[model samples]
Target chain A: MADGNEPRVFRIRVRGSDVVASCAETEKALIALEQAVAFPRPLPVNVGCRKGGCGACRVKVLSGDYTTIKMSRAHVTEQEEAEGYALACRIMPLSDMEIEPAFLSPRERMEMRQAQKFAD
Target chain B: MSQEGLLRPGIAQLRVLDMDEAVKHYVEYLGLEFVSKEDDGRVYLRAYDEFHRHSVVLREADQAGLDFFAFKADGQEAVDGFRKRIEDFGYTVDDVPAGEMPGTGARIGFTVASGHRIELYADMDLSEDAPETNSPMIWKTMPRGMRAQRMDHCLLYGPNIEEVEKFFTEVLDFHVPERVDMPDGAFAIWMTVSNKAHDIAFVKHDEPGKLHHLAFFLQDWNDIGHAADIMTHYDISRDLGPTRHGITRGQTIYFFDPSGNRNEVFSGGYTAYKDHPTRVWDHNSVGRGIFYYERQLNDAFLSVVT
Candidate 1:
């Protein structure tokens, strides 16, 4: 069990880069990433509306146990969500997570999903 | 003062993720008077200067955003008239029972074209702790935190702004005081039913029912600076300003509530006369229009909404 006083750090994998986050940080993953960016390291993904409306901080939760808050359904379709799409601003990671920015067009997303299946 | 039609921002019900944190932010930091927390855990609050029982309601929800903003009509007749006009304008208006909100009278609500739930009401029980009227003293209690005078206006983001303009202007007697013309057609409009520069504003966005910010009136530029101090001393998340807006010419500081909903405490915008021509801002100059000193739109302004 993670101690409330000493929250366990979770590694957030964004593409090839990694940013360290902790349960003690903000509940929103993008805000943790934003904190990382304050170290002057450029954030890997575009972020907007850190409250979950803009969908600019959306990413594919390639692997993770996380909780999702309500998001703009228009930006993330139910099908896309089932395929692991989640807005970073609405994602509260419960474990170390692997993610990729998912701002690609539908065809590109489809291609990436298929390639992932092929790798699987 | 406009004797009829929608008057000013009466009450705004905001959705908060944590009621305790939100109450602290709104009451302690923003300086609104805490009223009562209802059985449903919705908290009621009001500014020191307001005469009504309360003007703000915070409800704990899974999501944080505006639930609805209501305007106070002059009387029950004005409320009925607007309901008729709103219904006639092709949107369904429904009654929100008087007791639904504590001390508030019956409200006529409709989903505006901008996808915001806008309501109009006419009556509210007078506040027990209302500002002194006998000798018209400053206040019954010393103003705290940022000293918010009232819930002044809100800026909403959604699509179909052109239709929204027609809805308010034609039906509610609101007129455009300031507007921005992006290269991609209508972008933003500051509309008012009263003399204040804008009673509410709407900006075009793909999302529906997004609250850009709810503004509370401050005293003046010095108070704006003081508000900035409170925000910094308390480590509040600020989006922009202790600066002026070229559009409304108000001193403003945009910050976030604990739930990430944007809030503004501002003062000093020119009174928008009925005959005044609509001030226009082109896309190129909107940065200055929004933030007079920065001369650029912050990333947060265009993107962040709750």
Candidate 2:
């Protein structure tokens, strides 16, 4: 770690599903989502700026500590940010994390609450 | 470029955490001439080619950021005229007396919709280090470090750029040289009061009064590479570049001052004509619009500000 070649890795467990991913502190959480074997699918390569300019990779972190870069206020308001709304491309995980897509199907919302109860 | 209103970006007061490091960065690394340290502990500086006594000021502060950005008006009347226009546009205007900052004249100050303090003054003492007038050589003394020629422009991040853009063009008489119109609304704008590509630019962000970066003009593209070399040798914390901006066509590099305020060494931008049509960009090309080569913004571009 001192040599700087290796970075600490954290687990990303998507809420409402059993999907699990891993991420490093030096990369965007979206990269972890793409690398996750259990994620729904591969995120489109050209969908976002990979910079904070575009808000294509939005997510709602339910619980976790993660570092973040800047994201547009147009997409994520201060109120929304306080509520855990974030851009996946702008965040890097610090510990085991639980997140859900900003927009989820009604069925998925129900499942998330049910799963969240057990974790809490 | 017009003859009678705001002359150019003249003075900027930046807050720094450490005055010594800030002085080293601006004077030795960025090639600005250190002018004086006032009793208030603020240090003044100017580029070699700037005829004015100073174009930059550094103040010791708890955090790194911009205190205020000021423009030099053609004269007192222009400033007074703009004060009325600014107040009539729904923003309150206040006055700062002359000699508040050494040789500077009185300034009219106000906060824009974006939450940044903007000011305009009409006069400043000529620097003793100004370029020769008669039988003048190109430079009185050779430039050092990055050899920055002048204080060029700054980028600020805050909300409501549309209203900010309107305030600039309408009240300040600045012209829009380029803009990005996203589907939601005006995303960003590059505004100019002179022939240079931009005097100031703004990006839409939730936070108000955030300083994105302050840029210094270099002589040419090769000077940009020289800036990069200096950053590397001195272990300066650099953000991006030795690259070109598609919007301004400038060869540039972004780095951090000792206090974390972003700085840019820029050169080779197109001269903007007042009559020229405003260059427009959309969402799909925003990446290339900012960084021509990468065709995208780096994470730090949006997140890092002081």
Candidate 3:
């Protein structure tokens, strides 16, 4: 729902899928995604803390304008961010965007799996 | 006994996200004296007590992790001996020319079994404000932040625990003062070449080249509590602290820098001697070994690394 002055519509490209979803612009990409769609099963986004302390939820914006909150360099390097990688939980969309979530490295995937189990 | 081999944890190079924020955290808040920032964009700093030109080097970069941790060898001959031994052990050593870092001598570096860069050097120019030798006051200047005495030790996380343990002992002459044994294999080891309980340590993790924390030495328990107070006052992000490690028995507080590299300020551990038996911990009681007061491991301590 567009409230004229309150919100704007943006299109997002889900990584590894052809589906494009229309999402309401929000403070964070994750929140915007949650508002517009839901995943049938977990796609291993590996998010935690959501405040940028942990290096989870990392993604790469393929195209479009966006801004991000403060983030830990441990997760995304400035060079990598400049090259378009970002943390989805910290990124705020400013225009129509296309992003591809980075696949976790073998070690990172295992660590996330273990951490999720422990958290449960 | 002569101190003729590895002498101390002499230098640490860290990558920071923002130079301004890193300076504020390390200088004004942590109290290290800013020595100089090179034209190449690296910042050099030292504790008030250190005689070296600098002990910590900060580079502004997108990544936040250790660049390398170096030890001060007793002499040029000793450095050469270690370099030869390291090469003989199968890892190629690269020479870092003198003046690559200001006020420092040539260094030899090689990757260790656990995927961390370890370096050794034998010379450094004494700082302009080094502790006075004659009629010296308790300190040349008043301490700030937690009044850190020295950059003490670092805990690293990576794979191949057995090989790393063997490399430190067989190649570097570091003796283990404490260790944790997991069911699968050796989970962790605290090693030292000097008298301090642990000069460096490592934990078993899948990731290579991950930093657990960089610790600095504080005076005593009072200083540890004061550090906690300072953390509260400045609103620094804290992980855990003002607790004791059942292994080294050091009083400690673990916090984070703006870039998310964990930092610890601790005091009071039993003096380590080569003759002392290595203290061992079983996986079941390992939580107590890491945090004596809590007696339970926190999730962050186990998983968080930069």
What is each model's TM-score for chain A?
Answer: 0.72, 0.70, 0.70
Q: Recovered native contacts in candidate 2, as a fraction? A: 0.00
User: What is candidate 3's lDDT per residue for B162-268, written digit by digit as tens?
Assistant: 88888888988999999999888899999999989999999988888888999999999999999999988986767777899998999998888877678999899
List runs of model 2 lying over 4 Å from the truth.
Answer: A1-120
lDDT of 3 by residue, A17-62 (tens): 6556565566677655554546544433543334454565678898
lDDT string, candidate 2, A1-120, tens digits = 337789988888777666677788787787677676533353432124344433445689999998787565544556667889887777898888888867432234336545665876
Which candidate's lDDT is highest? 1
Candidate 2: Cα lDDT at B59: 96
- What's the candidate order when arranged by decreasing TM-score? 1, 3, 2
* CAPRI rating of model 1: incorrect
Cα-based TM-score, every candidate: 0.82, 0.74, 0.80
Inter-residue clash pairs, candidate 2: A70-B303, B287-B295
**Quality of model 2 by C-alpha lDDT:** 0.83
In angstroms, the error of model 2 at A63 is: 20
DockQ of each: 0.17, 0.05, 0.15
The CAPRI class of candidate 3 is incorrect
Model 1 clashing residue pairs (backbone): none
Model 1 RMSD in Å is: 5.4
- lDDT by residue (tens digit), candidate 2, B1-306: 336799899999998767897899899999999999999999999999889899999998765679999999988898989988998999999889989999888988999998999999999999999988899888889998999889999999888899999999988989999999999999999999998899999998877788889999999998999999999898676677889999999999988786667899999889998999999999999999999999998766766565
- The prediction achieving the highest TM-score against the true structure is 1
Cα shift from native, residue B189, model 1 (Å): 0.6
Please tell me which model should have the higher lDDT, number 1 or number 3.
1
